[model samples]
Target: MTYTGDVQVGGPADVRELPALTICKLAVGPYDNNAYLLSCSETEESLLIDAAADSDRLLALMAERPAGAIVTTHQHGDHWQALEQVVKVTGAQVLAHPLDAPALPVPVDRTVEHGDTITFGAITLEVIHLRGHTPGSIALLYDGGPAGSHLFTGDSLFPGGVGNTWKDPERFTQLYTDVVERVFDRLPDETWVYPGHGKDTTLGVERPALPQWKTRGW
Candidate 1:
């Protein structure tokens, strides 16, 4: 089967394999939040992104290996509902941005900023801080070379548009600018986007709509 990045709560996770990493995307919690388990193919060491909710299911997915850390994309309550429990069970270090660290359930082991690199075994992910949705919302980047770049966008960038700004023009502008300059201009169009919820999309599919998203002020 192909990895389409289409997953639903209560359904099985979708897996994508790259040359050096394997990404397991599972949707958990009532909000349909997407949590990613990124494992190094060479070492089998893994990192879980978001924890979200449903510790049992997330733990089961990690039963065969040890988790090095859990990265909370932002301070949103829905995004970290299961963080405390999962940390208790796995003892994984919690990573988050400094601005959002105070809101998380567990104390953050490390505060990551833009351009920081998170590593486990042979896998390396670059952190991209995207504001507006939350002061410290972030996206993770994995450059797979020939396989193309992959972005774990959290609530920053999605299929339709950037994350909601609650009708605030200032916030909408900030988010739109960061996404366009830091993400759209920096990365290639083929970059695969795995959002915080729902299915996936690519930069190429969304580039043309940038103007519309800006004009709509969403």
Candidate 2:
């Protein structure tokens, strides 16, 4: 998850190297959402995570690289603000959890649940269902081999705490429990976390604050 420089709206940060992939993080749209391009180094095919916003910008970032699909991390409006345009222009298939499919602007080409894995070239992304951030909120995990795993968390988990729960205590509880048991506890500390917005963080750093969030009732 270590990176340098900032990706202004319509631009991409320096590429990050992983075991079999190259990751480019772009800050796009009015919301400053983070759109990720995870490319398989061997095949050059990439998966766009959370088309968030700015079709022109996102498109420019992709350039001539072939994109396999546009995967919606959750149902939140901001996360998919530019989804329709991205899909239309790139001709990439759309995938999402059934619970959040109805919230998308276009029909989902594929519906995925926990334990399902999507493959593009030599890389495979395993889905992890995380509720509360959105009813069908999900994360993608790429086994990084010796480098640990890569986690794409869509507004479910973040650097300092879990995503905003809209003041719903029940939602907060659900998200917290899922994150703790499904994420921090199950994954190794070296896991890299890429969120829907802002900077990325590692699970090792975020693991210790679980108690604080629970105690604060956020």
Candidate 3:
């Protein structure tokens, strides 16, 4: 899928009847990792997903909203290099899975599990452990959205592929299976998947490719 540049900074898109969650996609580093800023219109609270790089621009976007917290999908440096700066500037608590907690630059304020829930006023986010790219990789599901369910899928799954795991063959396969069964299988067909990089797609659209992915033997 093709992304039409970055979603305009401050452009708010409402899901469900809840306040719009404005997402700003920051394309950073040589890998072009996507760091997302989830801003809640009702409370003006903002939560960042992956900090990546380009500290100045990332902080600038955070400063524009009521920065709330920083939630990482995993511990990969490409997705978390600017984390410390983001935390310091916003004084936002850092949340991550316990397994990836140590890889963080600072102590994690909150350790989230598979069934954990995060709420901002009326909106609630359900945590799903996708665990393929890394042991602690997770996906955040916003169920009350106008878009049905909105998934903030970190590096665990992407548009055309899953995250790279050339270092550990066994763990990589395990992660892939967890994502296919745990993440994709659990969601409804209409769920909107907002990945860490590339354009957005639905669970219904990507579900059919699972068998093909397994067959190819990545």
Candidate 4:
């Protein structure tokens, strides 16, 4: 089935997809940015992604299980509007790529790099440091986890094309190379991609568009 932005996974009714690796999605703030709460059913441990906006809403989502860490995908202001508030309440370790850490609202408690792995209960998420969208944009890939293979791409790879590089050909090239080598080429086609905003897509569908993306230069 195709992934749509309306296909939400937050509450009980829509929890049928994967209960083991529970993913709660929230679209908040003016830009309607996507924020995710990834929780491990076994340990009740969770990780927060983006913390984009609407601090109250994000805090409510973390009521049951406190997040051990809040990972910032990049340094963009839109993606981190509510970060400071969330951290103040949850006391989650702020994680970001060293290069992007300076742009964040607060100091990055933990610096994540390419190939680094983060543990949230039983699952270990691999960090992919992607360039182009932002120098230190990152995506999280879960291999053989409870929900099988899944990808959390924070403004990197999306349904139609890669994230905007502001027409910077050089940055686009770097992002393209990183996506092909680190993601599509390495991961299985079944890997589900949950983007930072809007809909999600499978690697199998996006894999065929790599050439077009390069040629067209988005």
Candidate 5:
């Protein structure tokens, strides 16, 4: 089946294949958080993004490869409900931004900041810190060159608008600025966005709406 980036809790994962990595996106937990299991095509080593929930299912998906690390995108409780169990089973190193590390269920093995690179097998993902959603909310960027780039945006961004700032103007501005400068301004429009919840979208599809999102002050 073609990759649609559509997934639901208890439903099958949506897989996207690139030159160096294979991304499997699954939704888990009561909050319907998306967990991405990324496997390197060359070494078969994997890295999981957000062990949100359903330890059994997440483990089953990692059966074929060695899970190297689990990255918690932020400090949100909903995003790490299954984290402890998953870490116990896989022994995957826990990675998160230093600002949010203390809040995660498991202690972070390494605290990452913007411009940092995480490597497992031959795949490397650059970290992009997107503040405001949480002080340390982050997005991982994988540049596939001609195939375009893939951004794993956890709560900092979504299809139609940026993450909810609870109507706080300062918070909204902070998130919007980082998203526009660190993300939209830096990456190409062809970048595929894999958000922490719901379906995916591309920068090209969302660029025109940036102004609208800012105007609404969300």
Candidate 6:
């Protein structure tokens, strides 16, 4: 499996034969949230991450790829405002954590949780629950291909800052620890992190910034 886009690929040499996953990041909404499209080369399977806003552009991106599912990182309206439009055009199954399912525009076909994995052809995505940004927030880990390991962090983690803890402070604290431990600590040092907003950064690069983040209580 050859992983394309921002993440690194790890695994056996045979896996290189697997189709590549292409990621297209679209900035939507006033907050400039990132909505992504993950497409597989071999099977032409695609997954949309965070519908956010701007349905027309999202649809146009889907038209260029084989869209199979829509996955929301959290339940915040700004992260899923255009969900209905994207779902209508792609006819893809919508997947989200059970906690955020109720906020989704349509019923979720797959309720993902920690340790749960979704496979589209040769590409397998491991779900990492990163609550705090939202009670049901999740980050996706693509583990196979030449691209190594790539993380779709949604609102949980960002380049210079972490997700806003607007609703629940306790949850945010828990999430901050979870992200630092589960995600930052567990993944390889070279792992690439594609956040819901702002520029992408590697786990290695973000690790050292934790102290600064802690100081700000973010």
Q: Rate the local accuracy (lDDT) of all candidates.
A: 0.95, 0.88, 0.75, 0.85, 0.93, 0.79
Per-model tally of clashing residue pairs:
0, 0, 4, 0, 0, 10
Report the C-alpha lDDT of model 2 over 1-218, residue by residue, as the tens digit. 56752566656565788778998888887988988888988989999999898888778878867577989999989989989988888889999999999999999999999989999989999999989988999999999798679899989988899988998999999999999988988998889888888778899998888899999977
Residue pairs with backbone overlap in model 5: none
User: lDDT by residue for model 5 over 1-218, one digit each (tens)?
Assistant: 78999998999999988888999999986899999999999999999999888999999989987588999999999899989999998899999999999999887999999999999998899999999999999999998888789999999999999998999999999999999999999998889999999999999999999999999998
Best by lDDT: 1
- lDDT computed for candidate 5: 0.93
Best-to-worst lDDT order = 1, 5, 2, 4, 6, 3
Off by over 4 Å in 6: 1-19, 167-169
Clashing residue pairs, backbone N/CA/C < 3 A, model 6: 1-15, 1-16, 1-18, 3-146, 8-147, 8-148, 8-149, 9-147, 9-148, 10-148
Comparing 1 with 5 on TM-score, the higher-scoring candidate is: 1
Q: How well does model 1 score by local distance difference test?
A: 0.95
lDDT by residue (tens digit), candidate 6, 50-71 = 8888888778767767468889
Residues 39-144, candidate 4: write the lDDT tens digits.
Answer: 8878889999899988888898889978999999999998999999999998899999999999999889999999999999976889999898998999998776
Clashing pairs in 1: none
What would the TM-scores of all predictions be?
0.99, 0.95, 0.86, 0.92, 0.98, 0.87
Task: Name the candidate, 2 or 5, with the larger lDDT value.
Answer: 5
Where does model 3 exceed 4 Å of error?
A: 1-20, 167-169
Clashes of 5: 0
Off by over 4 Å in 2: none
Model 2 Cα displacement at 27 (Å)?
0.4
TM-score of 3: 0.86
lDDT of 6 at 171: 67
Model 6: lDDT to the true structure: 0.79
Please report the candidate that would top TM-score against the real structure. Answer: 1
Whose TM-score is higher: candidate 1's or candidate 2's?
Answer: 1
